[model samples]
Target: MESAATDNTIWYVLVVLGLIYLIVLYRNKRATRRRKSRRFMEGKRMHDRDN
Candidate 1:
């Protein structure tokens, strides 16, 4: 019975850690996309100015 309880606790911890990892991964992907878009816009503006 005690082993069962410990197993449950471990599963819960693993699920919570997995969720946090996913959230962090999503945020990093979003930030990277935003940075790329911003850089692209800046380059476009510079090219336009040159022309």
Candidate 2:
């Protein structure tokens, strides 16, 4: 019985950690995409000004 409880706790911790990891991964991806879009917009504006 005690082993079962411990196993459940371990699984809960692992799931929480996995969720946190996923959130961080998603945020990093979004940030990189935003950065790339911003850079692209700036480049486009510069090109427009040149023309």
- Candidate 1: stretches off by over 4 Å: none
For model 1, residues 1-51, the per-residue Cα lDDT tens digits are 999999999999999999999999999999999999999999999999999
- For 1-51, candidate 2 gives per-residue lDDT tens digits of 999999999999999999999999999999999999999999999999999
Worst 10 residues of 2 by lDDT: 1-10
Q: Rate the local accuracy (lDDT) of all candidates.
A: 1.00, 1.00
Clash count list over all predictions: 0, 0
Model 2 regions lying over 4 Å from their true place? none
Residue pairs with clashing backbones, model 1:
none
lDDT of 1: 1.00
Q: After superposition, how far is residue 3 of candidate 1 from its true place, in Å?
A: 0.6
